[model samples]
Target: MNSNNEGKMDVLNNIDDQFKELLELIEKEKVSSFSMKHFDRLKKKRKTSKKKWFIIGFLILTLISMYFILLNEQLTYNIYFVFLSFVRLILIKKCVNTTEIIKQSNITFFNFTKSIYLNHLPVIIDDATDSWPAMKELTLKKLFQLFIEDPVLAENDLCYFETNIRNYNQAEGADRLFNDYINGKRRSFIGQWNNCKRETLKVIRSYYNKPYFLPPSVTQTLMGNWFLVSAGFHKGTDYLHRIPLNYDWVWLAQIQGSSLIELRPKHPCETICSILKSVTLNKGDLSNDCFFLAKESYWTR
Candidate 1:
């Protein structure tokens, strides 16, 4: 009788253990459900906030543009006001899941103005650099040689370059960077030689003329050009460099080598559209690859 009573007690304890485990499992599931619901609510709230701000900003800009148009009686001012209104309307109305990098083998000025300027899209103009003397007569080795010959460039002329793990946003002498690259000291730094002196700019222009497809107004602007140079690296590598954002229209002409260019929408458009659109700029049959970016287009290389 005693043994039988002990067995009964053991069964009761086993049942209690099972019940406790079941309760714990239910509690865990409830906590998981609560967490997921909270995360979703936060996500929705953030998205809604972004959308509200975008609308508010757009309305403010529209009012400002209209005010300017009313204040100025000039025909040009009125036309600009109208154009900006139309562009903003398109920006607000369109919601695209994915964006593309359009390639045009032979893009005319009107088409360029329509697609890139008015529509504010990113475009690649293929064979666009065929007319450039740099395409025909210049080589990367020759370009380096020219830089070496220039005293300003060979000595103290400053150039922006990508820093390694220790530093970012660095500028160093072009000569030193080139020397390190040549002597196997450091080949990882990618340099951008921009804002050249007048003499240096003159030398550069001799090799490349203004793109023929640009509107007359665009060509007249002296915003200058940027020369991006790096020892080639494979994609998905940390050694690759990033180009900075610009306020005005930006164009890149690939002198040598290819780059995977990725463009992101401006902050306001981020909620409505996809995050990134990429195009590979290659030196195909043409002398070089060329691409253009609207003033609002954000890009990285």
Candidate 2:
């Protein structure tokens, strides 16, 4: 009986040592970077419409003829003369109007491209740490990528977005008017996510304009199944500010523990869930399943 008891004790000691080794491994290797989705949407250029000189030349001629010849026509006297006069007047307007339109479009496009380029983050190896300014640019980039990709999954990520957004197939400079509208409101909406996600191409980088925050409204709009990210026992303060991200109701997993764990819902939707899905929670203070996994890592004692 003594020998049996001693053998069991040795087995238990070995098990404890193994557990410690496993814990050490988790501490060293748990950090992850986002590499699952190979985003290439940004590579495809949204072709810009070029200036149509033919239209401009035609407009010039129309205005010249209208100003010199049609201006003196008797008012509403001959139907043909009246029509020519109207055509010339319209041509002049088109020429002047397209000028502003083209300029605004180019500006809006420039800002729009910048906003998209900064969204994808090269996933970092140490995932558990982040500060507002420390992760500012990286956060902005990752959020932008996520913003575009989510839209693609929903199908609205491919349309061109702008002030007077012309149909993608249009040639008569329809984009002119659209570009004008967007630039006119640049600071308020150009590198915007909520307004553009629904109308943009998938994962085209629409979230980096502001580094500290991702749009909560986008997540709030989701209606299907989702995973809820919890901060576990850690109540939010500045570090958990990312929790309020607006996503749809998701499934929940509760974590509990002492402290030191710095991960939580990066948005409100990351926390707000419709149902309690599954939990990787353990018997300690700091823990996370930031990744969706069945098996969990946590303290037993």
Candidate 3:
């Protein structure tokens, strides 16, 4: 009877063990469910935050736009008063008005000249990255000052310099910034004039730097004496006509602080690499085989 009781006790312990295992399993499942629910809720919150921010931004933009419309009405009225004041001043300031009148006439004439001469020039060719803008590219008025202040440039060269700078502003894709930059003139028109001045300076520099090419005796004789020059023509054979390359080219250009100097092209996109390989400049030469073959067509511009 004692042995039978011991066996019955063992069986009871085994049953208890099974029950405990089942409880542990159930607890684990419950924990997993809670974690899953938390993950789902967190995902929802992230989605909601993104949408909420978007809505807030949209509302802010709408309010700002409305404010501008209201402001524009006042601005338009102010412009009319300002214009009227200008007209009265023009009528009264005869000397001031006369200078302005002549300036306007000159501008109109310059525009006409650009329409004829730079007809082939793309409007989108923006200004060069000139570091010394004031001294180098931004010095057209200085040209007028030169004749007034220092030596004089030949009439023909002087004319081209003036016109080129004027037309440089006409470069395509630069209308807005051009107008914003110029002051003491119509915001829109004046900026274009300033841009034109800068562009003209770049073109003038490129023209003068034609390799081994010198101007007429008068120009050579009067180097610094001449302020500007017309780029007549460059050797077509020196460079390939076209270089077919898949490249976003950013040229290393020089800017001066009241100075100008000649530099050679460092990157030879096509055949120029081969031609300039032998012609090294300042220890940097655009001489590479694959590059030269690529630009194997017309080289001169």
lDDT per residue for candidate 3 within 71-174, as digits (tens), equals: 56434334433453344333332222111001111123245223311221111111223122332433333333333333221122231212223444343423
Better of 2 and 3 by lDDT: 3
Candidate RMSDs in order: 25.0, 38.5, 24.6
Q: Considering TM-score, where higher is better, how would the candidates rank from best to worst? A: 1, 3, 2
Best-performing candidate as measured by lDDT: 1
Best of the candidates, TM-score:
1
lDDT of 2 by residue, 1-301 (tens): 9999999999999999999999987765543222222223322322222245667888999889756543433221244323433443343322221111011111232342223212111111121212222223322223333433454534443222222122322442323323433345212112111223423321222221111122221121211111122222233223221222232111121222222223232222133312223223322211212111111112111
Per-residue alpha-carbon lDDT of candidate 1 for residues 1-301, written as tens digits (9 for 90 to 100): 9999999999999999999999999999999999999999999999999999999999999999877655543343336435654665566424353466567767778886565555555566677777776766655545656677766555535334443323434454455555555566664545454544555555566666556775443332234456655554344435545556443345667666676666665544555655443567665222211122421111122
What TM-scores do the predictions have? 0.56, 0.14, 0.24
What's the lDDT for all of these models? 0.55, 0.28, 0.30
Candidate 1 clashing pairs?
Answer: none
Clashes of each: 0, 31, 20
What is the model-wide C-alpha lDDT for candidate 2?
Answer: 0.28
Candidate 1, after superposition: displacement of residue 108 in Å? 1.7
lDDT value, residue 287 of candidate 2: 22
lDDT-superior candidate, 1 or 3? 1
TM-score between candidate 3 and the true structure: 0.24
- 1 or 2, which is superior by TM-score? 1
